[model samples]
Target: MAFDTKLKQWTSLGLGTVLMTGALAGCGEATKPADTPAAAEVSETEANSHAGGDHHGAEADAAAPATEAGEGEGGVTIEAAYTDPVVYKSAIAIAAAHVLAARDAYAEGKTEAAAEMFAHPVSEVLFDMEPVFASQGVEDFTGLFSDTSAAVFAGESQEQINARTDEILAALDKAAESAPETDMSDAMVSASVASDQIERASDMYVLSIDSDFYETYLDGYGFYKAAELTFSQNEAAIEAENANAASAIRSALALLAEAYPTALRPDSLDADASALAVAASEVQLELSQ
Candidate 1:
């Protein structure tokens, strides 16, 4: 069987019950309007710094109105809003960082470290955003985050961990549902979706590198390893300001592009790889100038 098919089967078996519940709850509801305005613009590097991924471009404007400014005891003006896109964006960024750190730790065979990293976002970051969710009228938001954090650190089986992760994502979707209808809300929802995608993609990438899977599918493993090596070399070349680095980077990306047809990848993996390739090409162009 193809690797994607096997992956789907494995995931379905592991998450069948949770998936059923999510489907029943209408978890697939569309959060953004078809005509939503462009999101607040940020450079690719800035976005990566915030989210620790290759996500770029803006989908909808996330600027919330600063209403009811008042002077504080120290004569400092306090601009407050019941809904702020900044809060949502910050939460998403922290979540992404947590997932990335956890993946790296897991890949390094530090299971305890990975678990701690996985638990941090829910306990620290998402817990801190409880008030933001409350302001948007998302009931039980704090409880959900707390429960997910507990489950993550409980030393559960991989299947159980996957289920808990799904629950947390569903809760995030629910919070998005409660957000006030506005450009800021749309942007927040989009950001949440993007973060979720990045986390899922990272998980699948880690899985693909597992020793058993790599042994079973040498072609895919070899392709991915080669691509990673080339990409790293390109980075080093760029850092050294080599005149031929741009061409080398382009060649590396082209080699990575060949994996799409030769390897069996999940949809999320394919999408992320394509995005990275495009981003690398853009970087190569910039270096050539």
Candidate 2:
């Protein structure tokens, strides 16, 4: 099985889960309409950063209705509502479709076509986003696929894959729940090690592609090895650890974001290049730390 395909499926699920939860107030409730036109424009990313940590589950409780819109002293309790499930699910489905399409192409002896599908826009996006993700290392990268209790990328067959993908969509159909803000201790160490390691692997992969795909493949495995270790090791213990890492990572991400466009200009990479670059940077930092 192609590793990238599995990785993207899980990552998307995790991202989707976090995003949905952060948008609504109170568990599992239908969101109240925003009081003003200004309130409606808040970005999901900005909203989640403000939501605290208690609500990070892969799925939120379905029966709970969101609280009425009110101005709390600290901030307004805003509700999250979406027009259609099709929008988000369709985007993720495109990834699945690419994987299945690639598989079909490979089976039909159109290896180049299959590889191109897997390696294009999606790959580029992952590469671009790598620097931000590198903090969690392989554990974050691989965990994208391994959340068996949550997403279905763990399934061994196409049927299972489709089922899991659908399950993720169904979960998205419920009202978006908001998580409390999370502490950054665990994320920091994981991010550092994963970042360093992935960067090394990416550099190696780029350099050795012509000489040794096997070695490059091994490098990929090695990078994930570090990621898994960092991710698993820091899991529950993070709350007690240092909170400084998040700020540092945010700084690093800001820096990385600025660097992305310039890096891709000379290479003429497709969309996936940015994501892949960022992922590699994330691993590089983790391994180095």
Candidate 3:
């Protein structure tokens, strides 16, 4: 049987059921979007960029969705949204994405928020994945996450933080060497992670409709960022295999970027997040072929 099929069967009991993306949120110094899509954190240029692009260009744009914004929901944590079946390498990549987000936030003076993204994953799953790493002859590097989180909290300079980020990211890469072999194509795996994140992002957007949606909005923001990065990394392969599927993924990412414009929720919510879901659904159909 295909690994994904078996993975789905194995994960059905735990993956979707855990639904604790929430644990990832409000975790940074305790931290912590909107209408017209402009009410969010987006620039007019970013808003315009989503209009069109070739496969590679669109994929790049998707991954670079500016913070002038925003994830859809299940507590909205990228850790929960994208790593269910636990593609070891991709899970580590997701961790890298969170670190990148934290790096950017700290550069922008949002240190507390930075700390949250930096530390949560170590507790969430990175440490627990030790067995897989040990089995593969990889050492425990999860401690780096906590250490880096502390540095960011301590007001480390951007240069220092950048170095720390690089260090941890390198460790993650080494650990990914242990990711179990799978029957699925790399395109299939990347696409699957993208789909999971967008699905969760859609759910989070719905929850953001509430008047008390601060943390809820932040959750969605993280998911969207991670989703874009996941899809962009393997984009060329996915495009070569199925041009239509790749296009749909880009379109959905553009929609997600608009919906999740920033960490700060707007006073008025004005996004048709369903459009994002429909776009993701189209990509799924393409993948099923």
lDDT for each residue of candidate 1 in 1-289, tens digit (9 for 90 to 100): 4323432342334221222211110000121232332122222232222222212112100111221233111111112223444335434443544444443334444343344344334333343344555566666533333344345445556566556555655655565455445464342333233323233233223333332322112222222333343234335434445434444444544544443333333233333544544544444354435
Global lDDT of each candidate: 0.35, 0.30, 0.56
Q: Residue 205, candidate 3: how far off, in angstroms?
A: 2.5
lDDT of 2 by residue, 1-289 (tens): 3435544553454332322221212211122232211111223342232221111111321211242342111112222112222212222222333333333334444333333333221221232222322332322232332232122212234454445434433332221111112342334434544344334334333332332222222222333333333334454443234334433334333333332322111232222434546655543443345
Q: For residue 132, what is the lDDT in candidate 3? A: 48
**Pick by lDDT: which candidate is best?**
3
Report the Cα lDDT for candidate 1. 0.35
Ranking by TM-score: 3, 1, 2
For candidate 1, which ten residues in a row score worst on lDDT? 21-30
Tell me, by TM-score, which candidate is best: 3
Question: Candidate 1: how many backbone clashes?
Answer: 4
Root mean square deviation (Cα) for candidate 2 = 21.3
Which candidate model has the greater TM-score, 1 or 3?
Answer: 3
